[model samples]
Target: MKKNKTLSEMTEEELVGEFTNASIAQKEASEKDKFSKYNKLFDRIVEIRNERKIRPGDRRRDLLPLLTHDNIQVRLMAAIETLAVAPDAACRTLKEIKDSNWFPFAMDASSTLSWFESGRFRPE
Candidate 1:
């Protein structure tokens, strides 16, 4: 039997890799309307959130560079996740995505920004 390393047991690089993979998976799951799978992926992200919290540094900032990633889903999730540590860059990335007019992702970005602006959304 193989043992799975918990998020806390993973290094920063590994954590980032997990975050990227999960973000992509969640995006695809949502696109296919696989709500259960999407929710599970989101749960993984929530685990990553705890990983970030338990670490000493501002680990969430590690995702800042991903704001410019080629994949829109990666960029979108990175922006939303890092909003607390990098508001300017995150908001800029979200705005760019929203203005790109790329259908559902653009809609997602717009809605996220709306919540952010209206004080309805707060990244932990």
Candidate 2:
């Protein structure tokens, strides 16, 4: 009979959990070419980011540990999101992913790095 907490009321750990789940769902949706679902999940992840960013200490760096997650997509998303907080670690992870020759994700990592380098994508 416990009431469910809204995302805004969740703790930092809860927000990270939500971000992880949303990232996984987004990856699955993308694989199925479900653009609508994927986009929704993407927005949710961004909302989580915004929520964390405005917190007293800016806990977005809490995602840094996920940079080594078993799921490549999760790791990729974490690296991309944490770029502004930990640029060196994030770039190293992206390079590792790209160099691993893992299709789709490797390509994504490479493209993300290129975008960062060219100032087309700025991690907030």
TM-scores, all models, native as reference: 0.90, 0.90
20-117: candidate 1 lDDT, tens digit per residue = 99989988898899999999998999899788888998899999989998889899989999999999999999999999999788999999999998
How far off is residue 95 in model 1, in Å?
Answer: 0.7
Off by over 4 Å in 2: none
Q: After the best TM-score superposition of candidate 1, give how far the Cα of residue 109 lies from its true spot, in angstroms.
A: 1.1
Give per-residue CA lDDT, model 2, range 6-123, as digits (tens).
7779998898898899989878887898999988998898888888878898597899999988888899999999989999999999999999999778999999999998999998
Candidate 1 Cα outliers beyond 4 Å, as residue runs: 1-3
lDDT of each: 0.91, 0.90
Error of 2 at 87 (Å): 0.7
